[model samples]
Target: MIEIKDLHKSYTSGSSKLHVLKGINFNVGQGELVAIMGSSGSGKSTLLNILGILDEADTGSYNLDGVPIKNLNETIASRYRNKFLGFVYQSFNLIGYKSALDNVALPLYYQGIKHSERNDQAMSYLEKVGLASHAHHLPSELSGGQKQRVAIARALASHPKVLLADEPTGALDTKTSYEVMELIQGINDEGKTILIVTHEPDIAAMCKRNVVLKDGLIIDDVMINQQRASSYV
Candidate 1:
């Protein structure tokens, strides 16, 4: 459902240029769950930003569901992103004052959905992530795991075709991280395409395929055994 070819991204640093992505190429099929694993400066987040249309690449082509992102204008890109992509961040990006249900309903509100419909959809997504009981709670009232679950629900409430998660478990403890991973895995099992960027090997192992990046380049792409993959979810 997504294709990236000869992707390159660079930034001017003082008088020199720092390349962050170098001719990276990859294809993510519909309903496939994949992981992008890398170290501190591996450019995984940059790639995710580019994919989500939050940032533009310096060069190369990115096609999502047959539409070339490079060809889209800012307004068009924003619309496409809102309609097709869901993002989860390491920080859980929730509105601190909003109730969990309200936070999840925000995207739909922007999409012009009716209040009743938005609440219904948001509640359904929250339930899927096992956060239904916490719907009325504020982010401050919830645990780390509950916060992440609410974030996931917010992402899914958009009914996106692809879910791009960056360091999803970075801020949580092992138990909470595992719980979040299982929720994500369950989403993937229901046919949502998931691409996670993580530094944790155990997290990457949970994906069907793992791609390792180093110094802004893809170095390894491997598919794990089906049984091992099943264990990850």
Candidate 2:
């Protein structure tokens, strides 16, 4: 559902140019869960930003669901991002003053969804993430895992075609991380394409496929065997 070709991105600092992505090429099919793994300063995050259309590449072609994204103006990019992409950040990025339900409903609010319908949809996503009981709780009151669950719920509330997650399990304990991964796996099973950037091997291993990035290039790609019987056991 997503295709990127010869992607290159660089930043200019004084007389030196720092290249973040160097001719990266990758394609993610619909319903596939994939991980992009790389070390610090390896450009995985840059690639994610470009893929999400938050940042444009210096040179490359990015096509999401057959729509070319490389040349989109800010207005067009924002619309595509909101309408087709869902994002989860390591920081959870939840507004401090908003309740869990409110935060989850924020995206739909921007989409001009009716208040009552959006609230119902938001609550359903929270329930899917096992956070139904905490719907009214504020971010300050929730634990790290709970907050991340809320973030995931918020990402899923829009029912976007692709989910882009950056270090989704970075701040949680092992058990909580597994729980979050399980939630992600559940989403992927339902045919939502998921692309995650993470440094954690275990988390990457949980995905159906992995792509390793280095110096802004793809160095390896592997398909994993899904442990279907043990997925829920």
Cα lDDT for residue 104, model 2? Answer: 100
Could you tally the backbone clashes for each prediction?
0, 0
Top-TM-score structure, candidate number: 2
**lDDT, candidate 1, 1-233, per-residue tens:** 99999999998989999999999999999998898988888988889989999998988899998988886788898899988999999999999999999999999998999999999999998888888998999999999889999988888888898999989999998877887888888789899999999998888877899999899999999887422333533
Clashes of 2: 0
Q: How do the residues 1-233 of candidate 2 rate in per-residue lDDT, one tens digit apiece?
A: 99988888999999999988889889899999998999989899888888888999988799999999967889998899888999999999999999999999999998999999999999999999999999999999999989999999998888788999999999888877888888888888888999989998888888999899888788999999754423533
Off by over 4 Å in 1: 226-233
For each candidate, what TM-score against the reference?
A: 0.95, 0.96
Clashing pairs in 2: none
Model 1: weakest 10-residue lDDT segment is 224-233
> lDDT (CA) for every model shown?
0.89, 0.90
Model 1 per-residue lDDT at 114 = 100
